[model samples]
Target chain A: MTLYERLGGEPAFQAAVDDFYRRMLTDERVSRFFDNVDMDGQIAKQKAFLTYVTGGPAAYTGKDMRKAHEHLWSKGLGDEHVDVVIEHLGATLIDLGAKAEDVAEVAELAESVRKDVLGR
Target chain B: MNPDRTARPAEPSSAIHLKGRTIPLAAGESVLEGLERAGIEAPSGCRAGTCCKCMLQGEDPPAMSQRSLRPTLRAQGFFLACQAYPIGTLELSSGEAPEPIDTVIQSVEAVAPDVARILLRPEDSFAFRPGQYLDVLHPSGALRSYSIASLPSDQVLELHVRRIANGLVSSWIHEQNEGQRVQIRGPFGQCFHVADDEQKRLLLVGAGTGLAPLLGIARDALEQGHKGSIKLVHGGLQPDRLYMRPQLSELAETWPNLEVEHCVLREATEQEHEGPLDQVAIRLAGSLENTRAFLCGDAEIVRLLQRSLFLAGISSAEMFADPFSPASP
Candidate 1:
């Protein structure tokens, strides 16, 4: 089975996405980035993005990362903000009982888009 | 024709003097891009400045954007080619050439089931910094890079070779006998002990044989009389894989400021804990306010730690890393 299947597919992905945002929105270092964002809409878009990227049936129809995060840079988004998000994502995956190797794989996938997200 | 008269005016372009070659740079082009345009293959990774692979020393220092450079390096005018944009004429040095050295294997012993520690005696002129790596050329012409695990004071080269299944160079290294001759080219990489401030705490973390360079660095730091505390965290897949446990423990006993922690991924034994190496290291050493971290290990672990440590208040410039990727045979 693929890592997505072992992670319990849609249900697990949903749980992880929800928990990840919950932790990220409360992180003082990164919460400010989401002050003006619509939490509900952002969460939905994130769910689809994670689902597609992790090999689920869903396809992400949102904007590309560079376009999606272009405005955030003006708000002082930087490498530290990206690091905080990745930490929360890893914590969420481990909290949801994913295997160590599986968590590492997912983290790497998230890290691959860092440059585009940072618009570097 | 008049001696002062020129047939045509010189085109306006930024000039870069590198290794006796002058290359023209267009507007908004990075040094690396300009070099590549001139058919120069500069070592680089992630072009975003997260990786320091494209480092070069030069005069007329360009403004640095990345925080990966050490303060000492910045003062010395070392900059990353991928990030440095030259505004005027610049003089940069090319990457150093690797010198080939012939050495005789003094001993090869199994430190773990799949890990062998090979000691070599090189020619009298051979020298290398702790945490640097060397490329080993096998009899079959296959080459592999391994970090130098011995300090400069040792006057000998040491390598920790992980026996990859069916790997050409690794298998050859494991089967080699004492007094066997081998060809190596090296002493590359910049992730060594700098001794910038002897009072700054040292946090050295590695996984598996990644501990090789870290061991050398820790020893170098102590030899240099660094007054701050030094912590070495070595993690592996299992307890038995923490190969230098006895040696590191002995060093810790004699060095009052040095502490060694052994960790395992799962099934923690009484002596070792079950956790990731980065997390375990952070938990043991609270508050990295003034710490200089030297990281070498699995690429994924190194990346994870780089992000985590940067978020935990450690400046990116203070952390030096050598991420290891498996070489294909």
Candidate 2:
């Protein structure tokens, strides 16, 4: 089974997304990117990101990620912000009861798009 | 764009009808591509469902097109035009800006020091959900958005206009007299009440004139025979900022399932609860499970309430928010 199914699939994601978003919003290191953004749209994108990282069925592509984050690149989106996101992703998965190894797997998956996210 | 309408069966052949124009779709062509082929300007990005910029309301849209949207939007027949591949004739709606409707001011009364309760009678058939907002056009081309406070049964549009200091559209609206005609466009916004589950608890929280939309949703839910416990929390900077107390109290008294609470930041009266608005709302709400929350008012405060409520256990899907961007003076 994929890590998504192992981690409880779609039913488990609603609360996970909420928890993950709260962490991101409260984290001072990365909160600036989120200010004044459309809440619903951001939430939807975050959910899609979660699904992508967790190996759930999503239509996320590298081209899409690069295009999505292009506007934020000028606002100082870089490796540090990507690292913070990875940290939060790991923490959110750990909080949701994923095994350490499973989290590493998700992190590796999330890391694959780092170049695209930074628009490199 | 009412989702409550009975859905029609999809036709065997595929075509898209938009704004009085019908464009036949090539086999396997997406709705966005078809619209573009017909020289129509439909907003789109990513050419995929991820961006959600190409959302359109339709009759029985393909299920795949709505998979990424929120439940409320999905219920409202909203789908991404980029991802839709309708097998039958699809009628897209509200793509173009609606023409302004001429309405006569029926009455205007001051509900608070800076707020006016303006009632208007539209000369045209304006079909809109209660909590949606419409743009009131000023004579000089300036316009402002106000939430509808009255239900369809009232046969008139009720708007609560908070007069911003030196605000162009607001100042003009406050000075208008009865019998004066005004132009209005759109009944837009998705923050209205939906009777998905009758037993689900409802929380309506707003600050300042944000109370307008919450009041509309509360009454709409009650009118729809919702059996759920409904809580309406209205907050302000001080006691005087809270308006329409007697009407709210009368509503709560008439409906046993309804509860009304007034909150203020400072100078609380004996009848009012004094504290931070978000804290007060979460405290009074008690349990958050199976609860649907509607939050409105200042953009910053709405964001705070949305985050707090989501962390406190309400699902993101169940929370509907209408954050008003501050008007530049």
Candidate 3:
């Protein structure tokens, strides 16, 4: 089976994405970056991005990561913020019963975009 | 707009042209840092130039920091990007890098008492050069690199693994079952024959499983219609330890230009040479002029031969060595 199928596909990704945002929003260190953003649209874009990156069958039509996060630099997004998001994402994946290897894989994929997410 | 406005001097911006894109470099920044800043993902390991993973061809002469590169590679303008700083506008080329692939073991057998010859069938897209090495990710989460012993035409990857006592990865590899999936990451290193000329003589020396890559190199040279003589010396502590003697003898019979010799340290036989393999090879080879030499196996032997060959008038450009190291804990 494809990694997407093994990951439980759309339903699994949605639950993990929801939990990721929940944890991120409550974390004081990274919450300020999303203070003035539209949460619903942000969540939808993030979900599509994660789905596509994690081998799921979804097309992410939103702006590429660098462009999407360029405006966040002025809002104090940095390496620490990216680290927090990755930590939350990893935690959410584990909480959703993903295999440890799969969780590590997803975390590595997210970390690969550190420069883009920090607008470096 | 005032027509009399004096044009400001062009800002000094050093840059590198790589992959058809211009990446500006900051003062005191290495080429690798500039490429990373431009979002170009260059393959890197150890990032200090020791691993040679970030090697790239450039238009400029190699930087002083690139003195560790092979003389041939440096002469060809290949430099480690991690250590090189842009002098001016430079054009760098990094051809399509090979990606890691999943492979399944086809078979594994002990060709020698201590040596296991493993055959693997990689996914259809996986490809590698003959003398390159690959990193095997073991089920125990340890990674160990092994050289490829098979020719490209074989359609399967072959590895000669010397069983290391108490080694995590090597022991696991010896215990692995047929059809087990393995994650392989590379085809790395630059030790293959380039066939620069048809009459270029080759001297290959190997010890233990180091013979694996040398064997691949010899077969590749012969297959490519190399017209010059190919001499191979396999060294071991005992006569019975010269594992591939029969196969090599068969190969010698088929390829008239190829000569195979086995050298043992403590035993003497009319068919084999006595003493150290490197010493025996030097005696047999006579002069080192104009011959390409490849040395592999024990680190001490490789070092001794490397120094000996260099002093005997062999250019550093014509010598290639792969010093063997045991798998890390």
Predictions' DockQ, in order = 0.04, 0.33, 0.01
Best by TM-score: 2
Candidate 2 clash figure, as a count: 0
lDDT tens readout by residue for model 2, A1-120: 888778877658766888888889889999888887777777777877897888776667899889878999999998999999999999998988899999999999899999999977
The local distance difference test score of each candidate is 0.78, 0.89, 0.76
- How do the predictions measure up, each by TM-score? 0.61, 0.85, 0.58
lDDT order of candidates, top first: 2, 1, 3
Query: Tens digits of per-residue lDDT for model 1 on B163-249?
Result: 998898999999999999999997777678887699999999889888999998899889889999999988988898889688998
Q: How good is model 1 by TM-score?
A: 0.61
Clash totals in order: 0, 0, 0
lDDT of 3 at A64: 69
Candidate 1 Cα outliers beyond 4 Å, as residue runs: A1-120, B1-55, B58-68, B71-96
Instruction: Sort all candidates by DockQ, best to worst.
Output: 2, 1, 3
* Docking band of candidate 3: incorrect
Position B270, candidate 3: lDDT? 88
Worst 10 residues of 2 chain A by lDDT: A6-15
